[model samples]
Target: MKRTEAEQFTRRLTHHGEGPVWLGHHGLAVLDMLAGDVVLIDDSGAETRREHLGAVVAALRPRRDGGFVAGLERGFCLLNDRFTVTETVTCWTSPDVRMNEGACDPQGRFWCGSMAYDLTPGAGALWHLDPTGAAVQAIAGIGCSNGLAWTRDGTRGYYVDSLTGRVDILELRPDGAIANRRPFVDVTGEGFPDGIAVDQADGVWLAMFGSGLLLHFDRTGRRDAEIAVPVRQVTACTFAGPDYSELYITTSRYGLTDPEAAAGAVFRARPDVGGFAPYAFSG
Candidate 1:
């Protein structure tokens, strides 16, 4: 496999940096997850703004109409273009679990998974929120639910329940429901899979937490390339730049007593292929 190193894009900016989304001219948006902050960075790797939503901001995706849809600590919220919270919905009353990671489908539906704060097994679930402001439990019995991505066509989805140590493939129905699911990649001994992004060429770039590496898997699940990051807690990644050729990565300083200077910093790499823009939530 071809190997490369990602260059540091900025100084350590987050304690537990996660979800990364590339917004064309608007630059990049990432989360200081545990801090409940939405961080906006310019194309030049400069932090331009930071907006706190609640006790935790797990994930976020742009909206088709405008603004954004985000997964908060125990529920979901909508934000206007100005980063102001417009509405909020509590999915459940359970205070033990929190939203973790998610992505919007091509059909404008936002899907996010949850996990227990203490990492309790099977204490979380996958949720679906349609454009009409309706929330439904898509899947239950999940543990450490993380990384989610869908194919451009919306027919397939790649998901990670980190505790499984594998990435699973989901057969998505026309209505944004999962028709079937099966294992797609087994990273059993490599490291824990955290976040993922799919390229236009059907390549899945997965961030391996604690391994300091990003593994690229082709359409057939064959390892093709590797991007080495400076921090061990590599969290998430996304395609950015005008043409979406730039791969932006996020790292974390969580659970580290003495982390590297670059921990919690963002990094960038030039992959062979670009990626599609993030699917916006129709609502």
Candidate 2:
């Protein structure tokens, strides 16, 4: 197989950034796992970091009216207009899990996953939070829920469990419950799947952590394209820039040796692919 080519965009400090989502009409939001913070990086590349959040941050998404919402290792929190913590939902009670990856459904529901900190399989669950702040565990015994995306029409939901090396698709019901759980894709060899994003054409871009490659799959999970990066621990990616043509990738140096540390940096590249508009939490 031929090597995939990729171009670097920008190099910044983000230790173990797991989830990156674009804030419509604004900038980008990232979850810093080491600092346990939700950081907002504007269009100019200036970042405002909210620190000392919790154990570890797993995912972040923007609220419709401004502010943001983040999921941490311990629970979930709401960021107010001023980016302050307005409310927090802890996960220390039942199930004893940590938040992993999450995204807002088309209907404005926040869905996030929880897993054990030790990378133990079958020790986590998927949860959903409604507009009114009510939280419920939707699925249990999830190994490591990592990537999340939705179809264009908002009728299908795709989720990845890293440990299983499988991506599952579900039919989105009217009541926010998922049905028809089936394997959409299976990745073998080299890297494990970490984060994902869906394009306007319904293509899925998956970040392969250990392989240092981003694999693009069609709606049916067939390999469409691949892009290479210098970093071995690329955690997540999203479309940014003026026309939403540039793909911004976030990487990490966590668990890396000296050689790998040098390559742990955020990158950008134009894949000649069109991405979908990011979903905002209007509720």
Candidate 3:
């Protein structure tokens, strides 16, 4: 498939912009992980406000009752409409490790992963955080856990552990349980996979950090298409717009001697394929 193109959408550049999420009433949001800022972008793709969480904010998802549930440094936090940290849970007591990436399951549970500052081989773990403030360890013994997505049926989950260079499939049970881990896609190459999103057609749009490409893989784990961004540190992406056909992406300028104008700017593209509306965090 031919590569799709995207244009810069935001004026603000992040030092390490990572996760991009679409909230209808809130517009779009992207995080400068290390800077602890949740930057909101308007529908016109303009930077609106910068909400500081004081610690590394890896990812975030909307709460069912409004507000948001976020993956913060070493734990999880609840943010209100004012973007203030209301309730906090310290899942990891270690100062060296911080939240990395995550998303909500179909059951409305927030699942987040963590990694060490030095990127230790097995210092990261994945957890299932309940809205009731329960953080349960789901999977561990991994490295750089990132990019999570689920199938339309909610029976299968896809995940990426950058260290493994493969995307794994998880068995998602109706009772909100995950099991039967197996490799789904082997993206062995120069760069590790960063973030991912799923569309209505079960196509997985994954951001490849070093490759500067967002790969689209079908349910069968075949690379069907790809989108090219102007930056080399593309991080995460999600479907936005009313029909969820617009792909909002995030990138970083963590390590670049000379970067382009779009290095840490948010980008958007109309892939011609609609995306799935993400499940809200019930807890």
The most accurate candidate by TM-score is 1
What TM-score would each prediction reach against the true structure?
A: 0.98, 0.91, 0.96
TM-score comparison, 1 vs 2, better candidate: 1
List lDDT for all candidates, in order: 0.92, 0.76, 0.86
TM-score of 2: 0.91
Candidate order (TM-score): 1, 3, 2
Give candidate 1 misplaced runs (Cα > 4 Å). Answer: none
Give the true-structure RMSD of model 1.
Answer: 0.9
The 10-residue segment of model 2 with minimum total lDDT is 1-10
Per-residue lDDT of candidate 2, residues 1-283 (tens digit) = 2346666544555777667777765567666776786666776566755455777777777787787777766677887766678888876665456788888888888888887878788998888778788787888888988888887778777788898887778777788877678988889665788888877777788999888888888887888788888877787888876577878788887776664643545677677667766665654
By summed lDDT, which 10 consecutive residues of candidate 1 come out lowest?
Answer: 21-30
* CA lDDT, candidate 2, residue 10: 43
Sorting all predicted structures by lDDT, with the top scorer first, yields 1, 3, 2
**Highest lDDT model number:** 1
What would the per-residue lDDT of candidate 3 be over residues 1-283, giving only the tens digit for each residue? 8678888888646889888888887888889999999988888877788899977998889999988999989889898878888999888788988889899988899999988889999999998788688998887877898999887778788899989998889887665667588998888875788899998888788899977889988889888788998888899999987778899888888878887767888988888678867787997
Question: In candidate 1, what are the lDDT values of residues 28-119, reduced to their tens digit?
Answer: 98899999999989977899989999899989999987889999988789999888999998998888999999999888888999999999
State which candidate, 1 or 2, has the greater lDDT. Answer: 1
Report the Cα lDDT for residue 3, model 3: 79
